[model samples]
Target chain A: MKIIKFTFALLLCATISSCSSDDDTENLTGKLGNIIIKFDNGVDDQDFIFGTSYNTSSGESYKLETLKYLISNIRIKDNNGDTFMYPSEKNVFIIDEADGNNAGEIWVTLNDIAAANYTEITFGIGIDQDRYALGADGQGDFLAKAEEEGMMWSWATGFRFTRLDGTYSSDTVTDEALNIHMGSVGTAVDNYREVTLSLPNMAIVREDKTPELHVKADIAKLFDGTTSVSFDEGYSQVHVDETTTGVIANNAMDMFMVHHVHND
Target chain B: MKKIFLLASALMFWLGCAKSEIQENYVPIPLEVEQPSNFPDIVYNLDNNLVTEAGFELGKRLFYDGKLSANGAIPCAFCHEQAFAFTHHGHTVSHGVNGGIGTRNAQPLQNLAYQSEFMWDGAASHLDFQPIIPLTSELEMGETLTNVIDKLSLDIYYQEQFKKAFEDGEINSENMLKALSQFMLMLVSSNSKYDKYVREEDNVMLTQIELDGFETFQNKCASCHATDLFTDQSYRNNGLSINPKLNDEGRYSIFENPNDKYKFKVPSLRNVEKSFPYMHDGRFATLEAVLNFYDSGLVNNGNVDPTLLRNDNTYGITLNEYEKESIIAFLKTLTDNEFLTDERFSEY
Candidate 1:
């Protein structure tokens, strides 16, 4: 009789413990969803400024009164280096002169992210070719905002992918009206470039505290091709061209590496 | 008795665990969405869409509500009126917050599923993203999508509607646009006389005068204004002189090819009678003036279509007073009155 009672008590206790364990997991999982990313402009203590101008070799500057671009399709690599791409939404971040101070510090609220330690972060500069053809109906926040922001050219075609406007005076000709237009639509200058970031160490995301990653960007490399062309040359008529786009994309892609991320 | 108690306790524990697990992952099953009757099965149809009636109703409310605007002055209904076949009346350029004027004319909202493009410039291609244009344009609603979503997020009504639409009760831009698209896609128009004529269900009745006008249209306008939707869905040079202020080189703006200058999207004439002052610039106040201009006053330019030039000394579409009147009369038949008065379309 004593042995039977003990067995029954053990069974009841095991079931109760299992139920409580699940409840604890649920509570922890909900708390683990918080993620925070802080962007550090490489110029320490200097206010970050994002602006556009027509590159003129003559040093004539025309400020871009309106500017907007896309940063979409983010992917994060785990400590084991296994990569997981976040489900694509608008995935666009905007920094205006007012709110973000044009320094491009923005926050995103993400949920349901599995709790893990991540080593690297990667993302696309523009929309992928597949989603670009999907049109604007279901494209999350950024692509939809592209139209409202005039970043999209029109319906027959799609977004410019990237818009870099600068006025450049030809070395031979003194005319300042010349500018470079660089973007990707067809194969001529496909602007959709992927940026991969390798962290120095792993960044852990957990329950008691949220993980924060700081990324730094360099602006000088945007004009890497124009050695003879000085910023004083109005601006480099750095328009979207095949060669120029390659240089700019390569420069921007490297900007993500200038950061330190670790567990608190 | 002891064995029975153990069994009952074990069963109860498992059932409780399962219930708690379900509560954690519970996402409401959205209503099954079905294609509307009397419309062609277009590929853009929202299949497997768990669209609910309450969601659609909420979307309709947002569509007409001017409170979404920053100044609370211009609603989507302001530029797109239901009485005018979803096209504004006689306004060359639509007005928005603080009387700001938009660059393009207000386009009619209809049969958009067939279009692979949107806007006079064809910048946007999807129905879901169309609202983004007016919502953020300084000349339109002058509000950001994020700000609008943030405002709606706080509203108890919008929160519930988003839950029904997206199976998650969170008011994000995704669900907001989804709801808006759901409402806009339902604005389908296939009940027009033109539709009836296309189906051969009814005689496309035309007076002799209207018939003469149709013949002239076939010769002069049919090249660009093709059948079915009344557009080739291509850009063309209609020979309008460039306005220095606007500097709109039409397709040249995007293509950067000077040869493509003055080429604008060929607009549909479905509800053209109501959606005027006509032309890309809204230069013509009446259709008669437009006909007169096409008859004798085409600006000869490099990119102008050769077909639009005067041939056989006919001065292009050089229609006399009678021909012009008849052409105008035929154009009126393209109006879909059923679309103009349908309360189902009204954003209540």
Candidate 2:
């Protein structure tokens, strides 16, 4: 009986010492990880291709040589309803279709994100008025970046939130100029919009892992979403017109959806 | 007990090493902007971006540096010659890299700290963002912000200057623009003969002709060109005949509002004598020509400012030859020789 008790005591002492040793390691309560947002562009069922014709709901066919837009203020909601916002200074990004890889996927890698199980993601389609009011003081390298990308107006002092430069052919006119350069007219009419998308599954982010969220953006919805603007009806050349830009901005909000998540 | 203590010591040592790696080497030295007693409150919020000696020096270097252009030859100094109050002297429209010609005449760069908006049409809302327009315009510098940053990063002088000027110096756009602002904010033109006469300094007084011209100006031109700054900071249609070739719609293109058609920002006449070939497109070559145009050449551009309306249903100032000559004399007194020859802003 004494021998059995000695062996038990030895095992208990071994377990206690091991537990104490493990407690001496560093705690990771507030650690940072990285997340990749893969933007996949599509027109209806087929993938988006430059200079390829795509038919709209209004019987007007169009082909784009350039397709780009600005995305900013990215934030993700945790499973516990807590939100983690990326730093405002570096949150703005230009998702140019020309910058896509061979697989036609434009990947925006966000660094230093708080480690969490994110359930939903929210982002702005264009620059918000709050950011614009801050002026040059708020923007770091984004002003110059926007200018380089031809996403800024030369005559005016605002960004081209969505630049779709191409030609469209209506029933009456064939191969006419189609430039949908929508943006806020200074502090007057705001075309900025925000969109929130629910994830298909929880994106489990850890220090050693980088979870990728594949987002599918339907280009068809930009013309046929909530507003359903017609090309022949003054929607082809949307510059600073309040009514035309408002319809496009509202439609752009409904274009994004979380297709899948790769928690690798 | 000894193993637990040892493990704790090891963890503490690791954290101590990590903390030392992030230790900052930033040291700040303050530089004050000289505010002229006659000028209005500065529009630039200096609190957000404090000026420093190193930052000002860096800005001067970047201003003259040709690397800011696409071809590495046309710098900001190419168009903004200091002798002409930072304007392109003798050029109706400034030329840029690759034979690119700009549309509007180059605006002067003095007393910018007091003004809220920039450019002929008030396209640039802030002082810091004003450079981005010219820097990226294809007919101006024709350079991207990223390319300029990359080029400056490779230079040894900029690398060191950026470090000394900013705390978080990374040779980025923010530091570059802030440094440029520090240099520009220091440009104050407040020592002209007119200023001396108004302040009653050094027994300076305007001659009879200049005094008469000043009175005439106060009665006729003071409504739009109000204040000592010589600008009411309002956009107006001056009724100049629109050029068919350019067809520059002015401020109407900004918002596409029909009401804002042909309206342009009223320019400050601080160095009106030196900043000749005036107006947005440099159409008028001399002060006499500008006065004649206002007196008789005013066209009904539909959106002409109602302030210039006369009793005869005409839009003009109705100035006689003597009034024009005297006003020119008074305007000449506004040329501050000290600001024109100030070595602080000199490229050499």
Highest TM-score: give the candidate number: 2
For candidate 2, what is the DockQ?
Answer: 0.01
Full-model lDDT, candidate 1:
0.63
As a TM-score, model 1 comes out at: 0.50
* Residue-wise C-alpha lDDT for candidate 1, range B1-348, written one tens digit per residue: 679789999999999898656432224444433343544345455653445575667678788877678887678888888877777675556668974766666788877766677777776777678788889988889999888887887776675566655666667777777777767766766666656654666676666776777777777688888855778788888776554335567777775888778888899888778777677756565787678667754656567876676756333557788878887877776788887788877764
TM-score of chain B of each: 0.82, 0.92
Q: Tens digits of per-residue lDDT for model 2 on B1-348?
A: 567679999999999899757634445688888777887888899988888888898889999989999999998999988888899885556778885777788888988889899998999998888888989999889999999999999987887788888988779998899888888898888999999988889999999999999999999998889888899999999988665446678999898998889998898898888886688877666788788778876778799999888999998999999999999999999999999999999988
Pairs that clash in candidate 2: none
Q: Evaluated with lDDT, which candidate comes out highest?
A: 2
Measured against the true structure, the TM-scores of the candidates, in listed sequence, are 0.50, 0.54
Total clashes, candidate 2?
0
| lDDT tens digits by residue: candidate 2, A29-71 | 7888999998977776545657656678888888788889999
CAPRI tier for the interface of model 1: incorrect
